[model samples]
Target: MSTNALPPVVDTDTWQKELAALRIREKAATRELDAIAAQRRRLPMVQMPDYVLEGEHGPVRLAEIFGDHPQLIVYHHMWNDGAEWQCGGCTGFTSQFTRLEGLASFDARFVIVTHGPIGEALAYKRKVGNTMTWYSTANSSFGSDVGAPRDGGFAVNVFLRDGDTVYRTWHTDGRGTEQLSYLFGLIDILPYGRQEVWQDSPAGWPQGPTYSRWLDSDAIAAAYGEPN
Candidate 1:
C-alpha cells in the first residue's frame, strides 16, 4: 500500500448524514464513559502505609505529597539507575501533565515516581525537561507496595485520604496510561491517526515502527540540573 491514499469522497448531504450517525455513537460512548466514572467513584479502596520518597524538596512522606488534598495520582515512571535515557513513553506522559493546577481546585494532585536514587532521577528529569513534581522511591518499598516494582512495569496509582490514612483508590498501566497524554486523545481523531503501525488507516496512510521516531527526536543527553 502506498503512503498517500486519501479517504473516500462523498456528496455533502451524504457526508452530513454520515457525520450525524457518528455523532450518535459518540454521544452513546460519552454516556457510557460517564457511567463507568460513576462506578469508579464507588469502588472500594485499600489502606496505604506512609511511604517515604525523595523529591526536589528533599525527603517527604506519601501523605505530604497529597498535602491537604483528598486525592492524589502518581505516575510510576520507568527510570532505573543504569538506563542511558529516561523512558520516552514516560517523557511523553510528563510533558502532557505539567500544567495540572486545575486539578488542585478539586482537591486532587499529580506526581511522577521512579525507582532510583534521587540523583539519577533528577538527571532524568533534566534530560526530559519535565518540571512536574517528580520523586524517587529509592530505599523504600514504595515500588513493590504500589505494584510498580523495581524489576519492571510502570503504573498510574490513584489514592485518597481520610483523616490521616491514605487509601489506594485505583491504578492503570500500558494503554490505560495513555489517557494521561492529551495528545493521544487529540491525535486519535486525526485523519491519519497516530502514524504508528498499529493504527487502522486507509491502504496508503503512513505507518512506521513505534518509538523509533520518538527516540530520534527527543533522546538527546543533557546536563543534569534541578528543575525549579
Candidate 2:
C-alpha cells in the first residue's frame, strides 16, 4: 500500500500520546453534543393544520402517521417531477434506514415524505429496497409548509401527536441532517473524511465534489438487484 497519502508514521509511545490528547478533545466534543441535545429537547413546537397526505391506502391525516406512537420523524425526500430517478444524496442517505423497529420501543416512528405521487414514490422505494413507510405531499401543502417545497432540497422534520392533533417540533436540512446518516458518520471517522473537496484534509489526501460518489436509487437497485 502507498504511504504517500497516509498520516505520518511515528513511534508507539508518540502515537499513544497523540491519540490520548485527541481523545480529550473528542470527549469534550461529545459532552458539548449532549448539551446541544438537551437544549433541542426543550425547544418549543408549533401547532400544524389538519393536512391530509396521500398514502397507499388513500388520504391520511398528519397525526395519523404517528399511529400509536407519540413522536414521528419524517425524512422529506427531494423529488424531480417526471424524472426516472431521484436525488442521489437523499436516496442513498434514506436507504441506510431500512429497519426502524428499534424506534418503536421509544414510542417513535420514522417515515418518508416526498412531493412525488404516492405511486411513484412507493415504486422508487421498492426499487431502492427502502422499507420505511412513505407518504406523498404532492396533493397537499404539507411539503411547502414544512420547509420541503416542490423542486427544493431534502430535509428532516420531527412532529408530536396528541390525540388527533399534530405539532411540528423540529426541522433540519443541509449538513444538519447528517446526524441521521450513518453512512456519513462512518465515512467521517476515516482518515480521508468523506474525501470531499469541502472537508479540511491533508494536502495529498484524495478529494472529490460533494455527493459525486453518492449512488442514486437506480444504481443502488442495480447493485443489490431488485427488491423481493
Candidate 3:
C-alpha cells in the first residue's frame, strides 16, 4: 500500500502556473457576474396582490410570507411536482439556505416554489433536511406565471408585489442554475472534483452526470447510495 508508487509530477512548478491562470479566470468570472447582478438590480419592480399558496402549516398568503417586506425572490426549483429526486443542483443550493439570512435582513424573502403539492414539497425538504422555506403552487398561478410551471424546469424569478399587482422584475431560465451553485460556494469545489465523478468509485457509487433534479429522495438514494 505504498502511496508514493504513483508517477512523479512532471514539472511540479506547472501546478503553480496553472493556479495563477485559474485565479485570473476566476477574477474575470467574478467581474462578469457582478455586471449581470447590476442588470438584475435594474429590473422593473411590480406589486404582487396578496395570493394564497399552500404551505406545510396550512394556507398562507404571499404577503404573509413576505411579512412587511415588499420584495420576494422565489427560486422556482425544478422539483417536477413530485419527481423521484429533487434536482441535484437545487439540492446543493438549498443545502446552503442557512447562509441566506443576510438577504432576509435586507427585506427580502427567499422561498423555493414548485408545482409540487405542499405535502410533497415538505416531504422532499424533510428528506433533504433543508431549512429554507418551501412553498407549493398547488393553489396559485405563481409558478406558471413566473415561467416555472411543472414542466417548465428550474428558474430564479424576482418579483415586487405592492398589493395585488405583481410585476415581473427579472427571470432567468437557463444556466441560471450556475448562480445557486456559485452563490453557495459550491462551484469552487468543481476543480477539486465531485466524489460522484470518481472514475474508480467503489461498489455502489452514483454513476451519472449530476443534474439539478436529483435533489429528490429517490434519485439521491439511487445515485449516491444511502444519504448521510
Candidate 4:
C-alpha cells in the first residue's frame, strides 16, 4: 500500500482486540528487557584510577563527580575537539537531562563529560539551553578509557565506587544512547516514527534526511562564546 494510505479503520471491538494482542507482545518485550538489565547488574566491573576532570567549579576528581552517591552514570558527549557547535543528535539527547533530583533520590548520579575545554563545554551547554551538570575530560584519559570521545559518537558509562576507588561497570553507545531519550520511545509509537531515511516506514512515507542534519561546524561556531 502507498504510504498515503492510512491504517485500516476498525470497529471498537476489533481495535480493542488488536490492542490487547499488542500489549501481550509489549509485556513480553518488557520482560526480556528486565532480564537483560538483571544480567547487566551482575556483570563484572573493572577498577580505574581516580582521574581528574574539569568542571564548572574547576578541577574535580572522577570520584568527586559522584558526590555522596556510590553509583554514577556519565555520558561521554561528543565535542569534536572543542568545536563552536556540538553534534545535533548528541545535543538533542543531552537536552533531555534536566534536573537529576528524581534520579538522585534513587542513589544514582548522572553527568556529562566532554574532551572539550571546560569553558567551551559550559558555553555550549548554556547556548543549547540545557541544565545538566557538565565536566571536561581535557588532558585526561577518562574519555578514551570508558567513554566515546570522538566526533559523531556518544557513550553512556555506568560506574561503581567502593570507598575511594572507582570501577567501570558497563558502557553503551550509538543507538544505545536512545535509551535515555524518551523522545525516541514516544516517536516509535507514532505513525511516521522518526521519518528517517533508513527507518522501516511504509513506502513513500515522507522519509527525510537521517539525524545528521541537526548540527555542523557552522552551528557550533554560532553557539560558542567566551566566559564572562
Candidate 5:
C-alpha cells in the first residue's frame, strides 16, 4: 500500500518534440488531402441545370454562384424551426466552416443551403456568427431535388458544371461522426478535448450530449442583430 513516486516534470522539451511530430503528421495529412482533391478534380464535368433558385438577391441560377469555377460545394445545413431540438454537432462543424474565407482557391464555391426560411436562416447565421454564404431552400425544390433529408442533417455535395450541364460528383451523408473531417476535430489534438466543452461546463449551465447549447434563438439574434 505505497503510492508511486513522481519524477521531476520535463520542461516541455518532450512536448516540443511531440508538437513537431504533430506538424509533420499534419503535413502528411495535407498531402493526403491533396491526393483526394486530385481524385475529386478528375471527376467528369456536366452542365449544371439552368434552374433558378431564390437567393439573397432573388432568383439566382446555380451557375451564378460558381463564378469562373465549375465546381460547387454545398453544405445542406439543418437549422430547425425552434430551439426545442437542434443538431448541436452541426453547429460545431459550421463554426469551423465560418472561418474559411479563402475557400474560392479550391476552385469551388462553398455555400450553405438551409431548410429554414431566408429570414430565419439569416437569423441563424447571425446567431452562429458564421460568414459562409447561406441560402434558404425553404421555398424551393432544391433540397429534395438534391436529396437533402426532410428532417435535418449535414450533406456535403460536390457538383461540376460545363456549359449548362450539372452533374453530382460526390456526396457524404453521415449525420454526426462524419463531420469530424470538416469540423474542429480534424485539427484538434489538445489534451482538453474536441467537443466536450459544452459538456464539461460548470453547474447551472446548460449541458448536452451535442454542441447545440451554443445555439438558440437568442444566440442567433445576438449574432445576426435581431432578425429583420
Candidate 6:
C-alpha cells in the first residue's frame, strides 16, 4: 500500500478534535436529508393508466400490485432480450433488498418491474437468489411509461394506490437511486469509498473505471456457489 493513499495518522487528541468537527457536519447533513425527505413527502402525484403486467401467477393490473398496501415501491430493472444475465447494477441493487417484511408495517410494498419476459425475469431473479416479487412489462407500456423502457435504463419509482386508482408519486434514476442502496452507502463510508474514478478523492487514492467492480447476477451467483 502506498503511504500517499492512506489517511494521515494523527495523535489521539488531534483525531478526536477532527472527528468532533466532522460529527457536526455529519449531523447537519442528516438534518438536510430529513428536510429533503419532508419535501419529497409533499410532492404531488400523477394518475397512471390501468396497465396490465405479467406476474408470477398471470396477468395482473397495476393497481393490484399494491396488494392491500396503499404505497408501492418499484425498482425498474433494466433488461436485454435473450441475454443470459441482466444488468449488474440493477441485479446487485435489487438483490440487497431480499427481505422487506418491515415495509408491511409502513403500508408500503416493494417489488421489481422489468421489461424482460416474465419467465426470463423470474429465472434471472432465481439465478441471483433475489427473493423480491418481480413483474414483467414486456407486453405493456408500463416500463416505458415509468421511465424504464426496453433497452433503456433502470429507475426507482414510487406509487400510491387509492381504492382502484393508482398514481405515480416519485421517480428517480442514475445516482438519484443511490440513497436506496445500503451497499453504496456502506462503501461510501469506507476510507477508499467506491474507488470509482468519477468520485472526488485525494491525490494518489486508488481509483478505477466507474462500475468496473460491479458483478452481474451470473457472476454473483457463481461466486457464492449458488445454483444457476
TM-score of each: 0.90, 0.96, 0.69, 0.88, 0.65, 0.95
Q: Candidates 1 and 6: which is better by lDDT?
A: 6
Could you give candidate 2's per-residue lDDT for residues 8-60 as a string of tens digits?
98999999999999999999999999999999999999999999999989999
lDDT of 5 by residue, 1-228 (tens): 425233335669987887798899899998998998799668764444566656776767776767678778888876677654345556555666545556667776878887777776766666666677788777777776676764756677778877666777877777433643553454245333333444453333333355533455345435543344
Q: Considering TM-score, which of the candidate structures 4 and 5 is the better prediction for this target? A: 4
For candidate 2, the lDDT comes to 0.89
lDDT of 5: 0.65
Best by TM-score: 2
Ranking by lDDT: 6, 2, 4, 1, 3, 5
Q: Give the CA lDDT, 0 to 100, for residue 99 in model 1.
A: 77
Clashes of 4: 2
| Model 3 lDDT per residue over 186-221, tens place | 533543234345345444434556543235445544
Off by over 4 Å in 6: 1-4, 223-228
Candidate 4: regions farther than 4 A off: 1-3, 212-228
Candidate 2 accuracy as TM-score: 0.96
**Superior candidate under lDDT, 3 versus 6:** 6
lDDT tens per residue, model 1, 1-228? 655868888999999999999999999999998998999999999998888899877999888889779999999987656876667677766766657889989999988888878888876677667777788898789977887888777899999988778899998888888766787788789888888897777787888877645532154333223333
Q: Report the Cα RMSD per candidate.
A: 3.0, 1.5, 6.0, 3.5, 6.5, 1.5
lDDT of each: 0.80, 0.89, 0.69, 0.81, 0.65, 0.90
Off by over 4 Å in 1: 1-3, 213-228
Question: Which residue segments of model 3 deviate by more than 4 Å?
Answer: 1-18, 46-50, 79-89, 161-165, 182-228
For model 6 the local lDDT of residue 203 reads 91
- The TM-score obtained by model 1 is 0.90
Q: If both were scored by TM-score, which would come out higher, candidate 1 or candidate 6? A: 6
Compare candidates 5 and 6 on lDDT and give the better one.
6
